[model samples]
Target: MDSSPDMGLFGPESVTWKVHSEPIVTMGGLRSLYLQALHPRAVAAIAQNSGYKSDPWGRFNRTSEYVGTVLYGSTDEVERIASRIRRMHSRMTATDPRTGERFRIDEPELLRWVHVAEVESFLSTARRAGLKLTDAEVDTYYTEQLKAAELVGLDPATVPGTAAEVAAYYERMRPQLGITREAAETALFLTVPPLPDFWGNRALRLSLNFGPARWAYFGVAGTAVALLPPWARKMYGGLGLPTTDLSADLSVRGMRLLLAGLLAAAPEQYKMAPMRRAALERAGLA
Candidate 1:
């Protein structure tokens, strides 16, 4: 038995597709992680249940695959993947660090937080990276992502479905969020993921450890932190002045141009994410 949609939840015309296609969107993924970690129960659920400390890249790879699948897989495949996530989270539990209250990871509130953070990060990062979406298109992107919220058991009405709503939602959620010890550790882990051991070669690992590759990845991480809302940055103890947003926008533009040149120069060699690449081929735009 097999299930594959000739098309996924979105297509070439979608703002979702446009934003997700940019090579620099991975920076937004990192940004979303930091934003999500600001929630106490959200990060607590992650800290108690995730193998991120032991296998950060593996965790990152799985997350990337899930996002790609959700955005590009057929309708049935989307249901399959979402169901698997629902079941896994349903069984996990985390204790609130502040209240000592135990809560299920799949609670609707937590799922909504994660979804909103991803949406905001991806859209904002894409724009900052020079995607040029109009104000109406930004609202459309948010509305389109309601499909994503539904797949995860959230009531679409409860999730933000416009740029204005997203801003309001963040304002409401602000009172509930703050820095936690777990969030600080997660931030450190993200900035410096366990790399060389995962790559596995004596001399090659050393090259990676002290190499331009490591520093370059860190550079992206720095940019991701800069993309966070100013208040979120303050909660993380702040990294820059008011001009940091302007500098980060410039950095993203340069990074996007560099990546585009690299991809064009070596189209056959560049390893785009598998599901993303397949979706592009399916849409006849690869």
Candidate 2:
């Protein structure tokens, strides 16, 4: 385990290091995808290039691995993955249905949109799901994530790094965002993803049986939607508004407890990503 200060992009003392280590933060990934899909061009690109509907689990796993690498991998590993993504994005192109104009996936605006939506989703979900952190800590988390944005070709200085900046970014970008057909389909796919016949072992298969899986998935999806900003929810036609904040709070709290319990019960080796495990060992936390 490398304990050197410059090994990883972010050290243990960073708010991003702490926030991302929590098991509960995994819940935000879908919410971030849903929010990112709201942008017409972004959804168009995904619909055209990604096998999200056909191989949802594969897409999810890939996303999880990418995020984990960024959060916990050594500096060289981080740059390697980031460069791969950047090269991939540069070669991909999507045409605007409305204007018939083709645009590269690595366009600055699209990169910024994706970056902001994802980091905001992660921070918001962690806070709402009962991962305790102060307002200043939240700000620090946002600031630290600019490195991630830069990895994907976004200008770190231009990206939002505070709650206020995020809000303003959303407001400014609102005019360009709306529910496209692709986005609606994406929302549906996320809410009721098709599970594979066999995942891992019998225990996993039983848990993912259609009836139980649909019910459990809807519950988690509903909570994720509920945790979105009101404006974002409205854009999705009020998909997950609880009757009251009390209900929303209770739902999120229950999810937090459930995830915490699962993490505690699972084997330590299974609970953490390989890079994360190594980083923790290096920091003397494993």
Candidate 3:
């Protein structure tokens, strides 16, 4: 890839506009991120509610039951259902933990990972479910995602190209992305709350920091996930905790909103192998 541009992976395009303009198969890119980044525990809850047994990959990996049919189904049908999910979630908004400000569901940074994760998930879970998507199809999905990652501030080289590779990368990077009480509170408040059936003492603390408002929202569930050490966090990353570029801006609430957007947008490329390879092709970052 070219090293001339310093805009990270983006090529001088606005992410919000790009998302709207892009021919993303389902729900454009933002919806993809929501599905990709939906917490594993939350996914597990949904799975249990639906009576689907989650694999070792946890809740987000349960897409074999939902996204699978779409990818393999008629193109028109896939587009219709995907569009509905987006329309419903479009009104869904979340708060910035640091600033208490509200933001839309499809923020810029979030859109990038969403685009990437969906492509990844499509390839990974589909294959696992015994469907065979050609390399050409997988590659086509990946090349499009590389553009999205660049727009979001990640170096194309930094993004993995394949679902399997991305999964491995996450396993490798997991230790550094440790989950602390502070991290948990920040992560939880930044996104929407999990279903009521999923909330508990442990889930409460893992959902937010210790405070009146936090307690009111999370109660004890956050505390449970918070009790987990770095190892557990490492496991969480594999289980669908996001691994994406986060903004470093501290004073602005919007930047924190961007972080929420990013986390909410994770699981870049649902299937890791193709996505990781494509990410490497972008900048040889692999």
Candidate 4:
């Protein structure tokens, strides 16, 4: 685990690469954030430690890049980024609103919570968006991501490394989770953040910031929330009905199809993260 080969942690042949190289996974990331925020202290840690309110997309981009680098970056790059995160988390702390007790951000339970949430969200969201992944493949993806948990200082054995383990982990954790005011506010902000300007294109930014675009972003956010588990959605005061799930499934599938088409025609630079781009370039696919 200390050194990665040319293909990095999970190479092109891996289910990790296959699942992550999809447009729908952006919504998956959003879903993970929503799920993570369900834990009061986890959201509090995020709210207090990061400038997500002032720079949401920047925070998101960094998270996305970290995942990308772990999946596709070389050995040194992965180790370097992981070390930086461990160092940063080692210094930051957050308080529990319920007990008024302060805690380090990188506590083992908190780290495990975040990791399982991301893995579940990413895998489930991909399946809902119509990825033809099998149950065994789901287990494979989970097993492969064990290294990701390790990178952040968790013992792989302590983290869920299979679908059943993840389900059991959530069951054990649900009673400890609750909706705090911070979690609600974070969800609201994520649903309605302003559109970001594109590559200094003022005109394009202005053009894209219209009512429809805002509502469209809201739609995507809502769909991501919809993919949350029934209990989790109910805690958010959302209707956890079958119809809502059906509607979200249709919306995600449609969006994924549309985005796949658009991405297929997009320039190479526009369609991937730098780490992924570099990997593709090495494979002569870029």
Candidate 5:
């Protein structure tokens, strides 16, 4: 029942993937992937594609480019591009930064996270560019996606049954969502936002590399923003961070920074806290 994964981003005993009653949620869904194993895999992907050294910005750009090709390209084109990512991931054998244990690139956990991330990326980016959905609509979409997740071999217990339950689940898992938000903001401030035109009209395109974690985050965040008290929504809107518009066509890097900024500015509003710590600890973050 303790489905935590070690996520040693900083170092062993430094970072870990946290778990919750529901899976890690995001405004766009790929955030979960960026936080866990996909972080490394994404680095690997960029390294392979461009032979570029994997710094934060390089890795972030590669992620954005990969997403663009897969999501925005024609189905045939996306499949071809995705094949490269698949091949890259296949050749990778990574050590857990915490435990130094090696893992196959295509392990179920990794694959599931990747799948979710891609779905989330597709949906969130689509929304950002001009797609629309209602709370009920998203809930329905989530319900169907859960079925798809299960069919694709996502563990049944890992799926959330309702939107509120997803929020409550994240709250239970990390309790550090707010603190992580602070860290996320700090990270963002240190990095430049991806240029606005970098994505261009490509936002309308769907990619296979979309991370599920980003999608879940987008969905949860969107739902949270909409369902907030009118005063809160107005406040957030005044800040120019409306959930409805936050995830649109945002580069993966932009999305990360935007989310971080929101959390850092109003950690209380998002209930950021130690939940990620527990989840990461379970994953071997500690």
Candidate 6:
């Protein structure tokens, strides 16, 4: 494997590096997926081509690995993964049931939606979770993530790179987005993913099979929903909340504290990506 002395993509000094290194961002992954599903064409493409429902964890793991690679891998590794994703998207297409029009998965609009949704979710979740990022740093984080947006075939110039820009982008996209049946179905699946029978631990499987897992899942699902923007929450018909922003804030803060505590107890090697670990070692920070 080729290693770079330079920090790949955003580098250690970048806000993206600081924010993404946190374990709490895992919640943003679910938020991003849920938000993306609300885009009818994106969800349609996913349903047609991906095994998301049957292998949600597998899909999520692969996506997480790719994101980690982009954030922490060598320059060549970053390009390699980005190129692979571009090739895959270029070969896939989905037809819109509403219009009967076939569109490529790499369509600029779809790519932009996925990119913006993910970046916005990440920043929003980190802030709500008490990550202590200043408004300027948050803007920097968004601007830094343009490199990631470009990885998914979006034009960086067209992507939003500030909080205000993101809000404007959502405003512009609101008319095109809604809670479709596919979105609703995907949301349900995300909230309560079925545990595989062959999960290799009988006791764990039994627990999930009974009720504990479902209860735990609902707690997480509720928090993920609470993290959604007010507009998105409304679109989902108040599944996450029917009350006040204060309640949502409190829930998110509590979840953040729980995640932070867990991360604190975990070993450094377990909490960080391998590339990040290596970078920290090299910098004498580990």
Question: How much lDDT does candidate 4 score?
Answer: 0.88
Candidate 1 on 1-286: residue-level lDDT in tens? 6543366788878999888888888888899999999999999999999999988878887887788889998778888999998889889999999999999998989999999999899999989999999999999999999999988888998899999999999999999999899999989988987673757778887778778988998989999998899999889888657798998999999999998888888857465777877877776778
lDDT of each: 0.89, 0.82, 0.39, 0.88, 0.41, 0.83
| Per-model TM-score on C-alpha atoms | 0.93, 0.91, 0.32, 0.93, 0.37, 0.92
Candidate 4 ranges with C-alpha deviation above 4 Å: 1-5, 197-210, 283-286
Model 5 stretches astray by more than 4 angstroms: 1-61, 114-132, 140-286
**Model 4, poorest ten-residue lDDT window?**
1-10
The C-alpha RMSD of each candidate to the native structure, in angstroms, is: 2.6, 2.8, 18.1, 2.7, 18.2, 2.6
lDDT of 6 at 29: 81
Q: What is the lDDT of residue 54 in candidate 4?
A: 86
Per-residue alpha-carbon lDDT of model 5 for 117-162, expressed as tens digits? 4454434443443344566654554454453354334575676544
Which whole-number lDDT from 0 to 100 does residue 156 have in model 4? 98
**Model 1, stretches more than 4 Å misplaced?**
1-5, 196-198, 269-272, 281-286
| Candidate 6 residue-wise lDDT, 112-197, digit = tens | 99989998888788777778899999899999999888888788999999989999999999999997777888898888788875
- Number of clashing residue pairs, candidate 2: 0
Reference-based lDDT, residue 226, model 4: 91
lDDT of model 3, residue 102 = 63
lDDT of 6: 0.83
Question: How far does residue 272 in candidate 6 sit from its true spot (Å)?
Answer: 2.5
Best model number under lDDT: 1
- Is candidate 3 or 4 superior in lDDT? 4
For each candidate, how many residue pairs have backbone atoms clashing (under 3 Å)?
Answer: 0, 0, 51, 0, 60, 0
Q: On residues 26-103, what C-alpha lDDT tens digit does candidate 3 reach at each position?
A: 221222333333333322222223322223224344343234323222334445555665565465565543345666
